[model samples]
Target: MIDISASPTSTTLVVSGDLDLAERDQFPEVTARVTGLRRQLVVIDMCRVTFMDSTGAAFLISLADSSRNRGGAAVLRGADARDLFVLEVCGALELFRIDRDHRCDDVPDAVEEPSIV
Candidate 1:
């Protein structure tokens, strides 16, 4: 099960859940939803994710690329040791900007209001 929530203030997408092959079907929809968003910073919360595979890694890479093409940033959060291992093994770690802070409680409070340039 995957849950995606967006912070209006920060324009960040907080995603939590298992992103293994079972949830691969939902990846396109998820990517579409984020791609349609006009936000500049997309922070994906992956803390709740229990497992991942090569397919999941690919999905993340695609999302990151799309975000970049649109002049936005896609960041991965809550990457536990196991998650990091998976990404390293898949040789896709360079494709993502992984957050190593492990600080999930401050996301809401740290969110800054959206701004226009």
Candidate 2:
């Protein structure tokens, strides 16, 4: 499942469970809310995501690319070893803005409120 939230200055997407072939297509819907923002900090929390494949990595990389085009940044947080491996194999580890020190309360603007399901 996925939970999305937005603060004054940032948007956060928390993804748990597995991100394999079955879950790969869910990226667009999850990222749609933040892809158009400009100068916004987008945080994708994958700390709880148990499994991820190259498809998942590609989706994330694409999402991050889209955000960058709009002057926003996509920060990936808490990617475990398996997920990290996919990213590394794809040579996408350096493409994203990794922020391990991100704090939820630290927002800079007021964005639309997010939801969880």
Candidate 3:
């Protein structure tokens, strides 16, 4: 599941549950909505994510790449070692700004209703 919140300058994607091939069908739509925001900052809050596979890493990479291509940035907040490892193995760890200091308790209510995919 993912909950998206946006401000004029940034968009936050609060991710939870499992992120793997099972969730691939939802990736495109989520990607389009997020990228369409055109915010300068994209924050991916992954503290609640229990598992992530290569497909998840690919989705994250795509979001980061899209943000960078538009002169923006993508931030990964609260990613655990397992999630980090997946990104690392995929050679996409450097694509995002890792925010170790951010906490899930810091998330605000979604500006847009939470979308379960």
Candidate 4:
């Protein structure tokens, strides 16, 4: 599941379960909504993600790229080494800011109104 929340300056995506080919169908709509927000920051909470394949990495890269193009930034919270490795292998690690110290619980309520999709 993916839950999106937004504040005036940032948007957060709380991702759970596996982010692989099976979840591909949801990526487009989620991407559109997130990019359309035009927020200055995008936070992807990956603490609950069990597995992520290349497709998931591509989705993350797309989000980071879009945010960068708009002069914003994308942050990945609670991402493990495996996730980072996937991004690195894809040559897209530089696209995001990895916050290894941050966890899902540390996310502020400023992103309180989540819309599940």
Best-to-worst order by lDDT is 4, 3, 2, 1
At residue 85, candidate 3 shows an lDDT of 79
Task: Report the C-alpha lDDT of model 2 over 33-57, residue by residue, as the tens digit.
Answer: 6664443677888766768888788
lDDT of 1 at 102: 51
Q: List the residue pairs that clash in candidate 3.
A: none
* CA error at residue 89 for candidate 4, angstroms: 0.5
Give one digit per residue, the lDDT tens place, for model 4 in 62-102: 99999999999999887777877888899998888877556
lDDT of 1 by residue, 1-110 (tens): 55555666334555555667887888898888877775667777775565778888788778778877878777777666666667778776666666665565644433
Question: Among these predicted structures, which one has the highest lDDT?
Answer: 4
| Better model by TM-score: candidate 3 vs candidate 4 | 3
- Model 1 bad stretches (over 4 Å): 7-11, 104-117
Highest TM-score against the true fold, candidate: 3
- For each candidate, give its TM-score against the true structure: 0.74, 0.76, 0.87, 0.87
Cα lDDT tens digits, model 3, 2-108, are 89999989999989888899999999999999999999899999877878999999999999999999999999887877788788889888898887666566544
- Per-model root-mean-square deviation over C-alphas: 7.6, 9.1, 7.5, 7.6
